[model samples]
Target: MKTDPTYPLFPICAFLGFIISLVPISWHFQAWNAGTCLYMFWVSVACLVQFVDSVVWHGTLNNHAPIWCDIASKIIIGAGVAIPAASLCINRRLYIVTSVKTVSFTVEDRRRAVYIDLAIGAGIPVLVMILHTVVQGHRYDILEDVGCIPVIYNTIPAYPLVFMWPVVIGCVSFVYAGLTLRAFLQRRASINDVLSATTTLNVNRYFRLMLLAFIEMTCTVPLSAYSIYINTSGVTLAPWISWSDTHFDFGRIDKIPSVIWRSDHAFYVSVEMGRWIYPTCAFVFFGLFGFASEARKHYRMVWMFLAPRISLVRLNPRCVQFRIIGTMP
Candidate 1:
């Protein structure tokens, strides 16, 4: 393994991204039980751990972070795989189960949607992981410092890390896409139909946001497939990044430097680069596209909360007070 001076920079930026994402997430924590929000929250957390493990914890420290972070990270890694599928399925169900004449969904339907999404988002991966543990070995290679990779990648009878999950997600996405296209056209059959919906229900916005979420998820599929291919085909696409800060006894040499070193398995490093991309894009889309009013409200709320005293300024001494309209009073 060769050293790259730029490697540390990648994880540093990724860690900062995960940290920044937490702010909006904090604002939305009370919203987890809402439809799609719970799955999205878990997915965000999974991305956070991916960044930490792949980039930040680069030494013996990797082996010794808070235990929950480790456990949560691994479980949600699989949960992330099922998230988009769960989202699309529930969204399509909402569209179908709603009043076609009224063009609106019910809160009761949304609550039920939450349950179905959770089942798909959390259930499939847990079952697969359990099956893997019983059929394969332990998921992580702690003795060799492989971190939290599935043993299915390198075990005998070699189950793929990618195969069934991608197939399932792809199948679900395809069905969702077809159904959504038809729904979109039927609802927008004319400007009257659209304006009628705008005045009465405005349910189209929910569908649009669902479409945006699917688009973002679609973009991540290629990267995911490549990672899977590498593992399944037994190709060492990348090297392992070991926790290099540990002391190694080399018999002849007194000690080995424990700083960051390029190890085997570069697949993880490459995948980590894109790990934050999907969650980041999805979060931004949800904020601006789905929760535009809420985002603006939060922005204004924060601005006023922070700078309520600077609303207007006095330019001159002789009763010359001018109200600052836009910014920087």
Candidate 2:
């Protein structure tokens, strides 16, 4: 099946997601919204991975920049997988869990927690990619699969390394969020009391934040499943298309080493479909839904700043004409 017709949409989605993520990132004041910044950081990374994928996949440069193309392809793919999940994990552990359970919070505590989150969020991906590379035989060649370079897939380590941990973390978060939501909803803690009422409001607020994390998990988990399915399925998946040079309608696909990670036509195309689309969904969801109220505030402020400038620019042309006439006189 000629899937190339749909290829154009992925890049467009990637670019759009990248642009949307900037809104929350810009609004983030770390002191007030530290967890949000942590979450948004990974969301931005995922979007960035897609944006780069859009560029190199459809363009002519992927194969030529082997080191960059190969290393970046793996790292970003890992980033795409690990970062958002790690962000959610961190947000749940530090913010939601801590708040509801009355967990202690000290200056060093937050610092240590954030450092851990950043390290895990960023580190795991790199480590996974490297391990994947080693296990896969370190193939640095142009992975001219589908329209773009495919990430590490179909490896033994991928399940535990790439997919399992995130799944576990997301599950833990969802359960805690559910429990926390129950506490707020049931009002068993005596809603008539002012202190309890305030606690409900606080828990409700934290639960909403957790919901945002859940939304991210909803977007990402399916992508991972789809990848695992297509790769591991017994059915003959796209036997018609080759992941090799024969499938290449254009460009010089050089022979490079093969890694432990492998790809087939079905899996490659399947991956392309999900890669940008998931992150795009994630970025848009968080950008619009997660930050809806905040976004409106920011949007109003931006309009206030830009409206006068726009009016001035509109008025400038006439002023320029008048000034020209006056100078001539």
Candidate 3:
């Protein structure tokens, strides 16, 4: 086997991903989970882990970090955040279609929609984790002159590699979501016979689906473009730079001797471009949080709208309203 230094961080990140995915399942059984709510819950876990890991870990670790550790941390962190955005957009599409309908669709149909979306968002990551483990042995190689804990800055090659999966998944999901919403919109005015729903309900579904698609694509395009730029460039910020102040006076020729060496052009380009792209990702992340906030607000509105109409009793008398026959005013 080749001596590669980054093996350790992989297990850590993958384990974190598993934990993130598992929590929603637990919530499902424990929290009386609604289908739409479960998707949001799953997304929250992914986003939290990614946000914490990327910002905290990268801020500390310097170059000479291990390969496996670096890659694992980034992948887990990026996916944690990006996946939730994707899932929410998907959930929005499903909810707008299914929820507003007054038709008596089977429980199985609802469950099928939920599981299919889950598979699209979470299933791919699970498969990738398994494949990575099987192909590469579990242990990660530690980097020289690095702290025991894994960090992203010290780990150079791993940065682009880490975002590879998340970018692919996010872009694909965004495209699918956009197309689905567009199709729905084109059919909007022509939805002649919706399943026993009022005109207001039909209008809500039409508008919400389009809104979800718009949000998903708008947020994802920046992230995907940034990821692709970094990946293609093949350079990373110096892990050492991330840690130490490199601003010491090089003008002191008496105190220090500078040695010139042949530079890798590809590496230089990667570093320069990555600087810009990284911040683009940060912006994408902020946009996603905004999207989630909007979703929470929308969910509350949905519940509020439904509350007056729903009842505990199967055949509540309140479900019907009677009009008095012609009485003298």
Candidate 4:
């Protein structure tokens, strides 16, 4: 019927997504992952739009923030919600053609695509958020400092916990990335033969998702592993005011550090370095690849395998064609 209830759910979804983005931001001013940062940037603009929309037309902030927010806002809310929202917006034309043009696809197939997007886009993020919330809430007294605040939870303790966050993030990201990539590839293969520039562009759109997933996982995994290594073995003597040193003594209380020296776990620095290196690569690669991919496909010359872009890249090509049901020639 009416384009799968997006208008009704858009407001709820947008606020939740914004809240999710704020979580990492609360973790103290470290840079957000590439995807999240972009999403957040859009969200800020979206929030402003909502504010303007309400003030200009007597709309309330509570109702406005999410409702007026962009589609990227929907996707960030969670994979379950985001995926369907993306699908509805992404494949609206396809669904319309299927209905009016008498395309061979069953309504069930259309629904399935919607379901898959929801599953991948919303499901993955929700799962990770849950896991992180439950198992990774470490204990660290928030302190005012110039550098970023360290999260020190049992799941992220120096010895055993350090490895937890990175590993969890890495594993979740790895699985999601792999599945998303496979799906993108499959979609690309299916649509590659369609000569219509529109079809090609639609399919190629999926490539961006694959690239995004790949960038997130690849960038974060090694960092996680390195974090685990540093947390486990790299125990450095704390400064005079370190929480550990203040609360518990490791028998070196009297020796104040005139100079800092590496302990047995100094090699852990290398692991931390590796983590940074990999994600830096991912960050750089994602930026370059996205720019290039969009440029190459700008005229709708290539077959796309993923959903279309909302910003930065545009694939709204007119070549997207539709054939009536059973009318494939």
**What is the per-residue lDDT of model 4 for residues 1-329, given as tens digits with 9 covering 90 to 100?**
11212232333433443343333322112311223333333333333333232233221112222232323222222332222222222233232222232224455664574465444434555554344323222321111110011232332223232234445545655655555445434554444333133322333334444444455456455655655556545455333344453434322112111122122235325322422332233334335333454444542343343423322233445555444445564
User: Which is the better candidate, 1 or 4, if ranked by TM-score?
Assistant: 1
Give the range where candidate 4 is weakest over 10 consecutive residues by summed lDDT: 140-149
**TM-scores, each model vs. reference:** 0.64, 0.66, 0.43, 0.35
Runs off by more than 4 Å, candidate 3: 1-39, 50-104, 134-175, 178-182, 190-209, 235-329
* Candidate with more favorable, higher TM-score: 1 or 3: 1
Candidate lDDT values, in order: 0.47, 0.51, 0.41, 0.35
All-Cα superposition RMSD per candidate: 8.5, 8.2, 15.3, 18.1
TM-score between model 1 and native:
0.64
- Error in Å for residue 283 of model 2: 4.3
Write candidate 1's Cα lDDT for 210-309 as tens digits: 5654664565466556655655564533322332311112111111122321243464454344354545644554554445554566866665565536
Among the numbered candidates, top lDDT falls to: 2
- TM-score result, candidate 4: 0.35
Q: Cα lDDT for residue 257, model 1?
A: 20
Model 2 ranges off by over 4 Å: 1-3, 31-35, 59-62, 90-106, 140-158, 186-208, 218-223, 234-265, 286-291, 307-329
Off by over 4 Å in 1: 4-8, 16-35, 54-56, 59-62, 65-73, 89-99, 104-107, 142-148, 153-162, 190-204, 235-291, 306-329
Worst 10 residues of 3 by lDDT: 253-262
lDDT of 3 by residue, 1-329 (tens): 22212234432443344344333233233322243233444444443433343433332333333454446443544344444344444545444454343444466765665576566555655555443432221233221212222123224433344445655555665666655556556655644455234322344333443454455556555755664564446444444342123323311111100111004444334333322332333333334333343435655555556654564212233453333334422
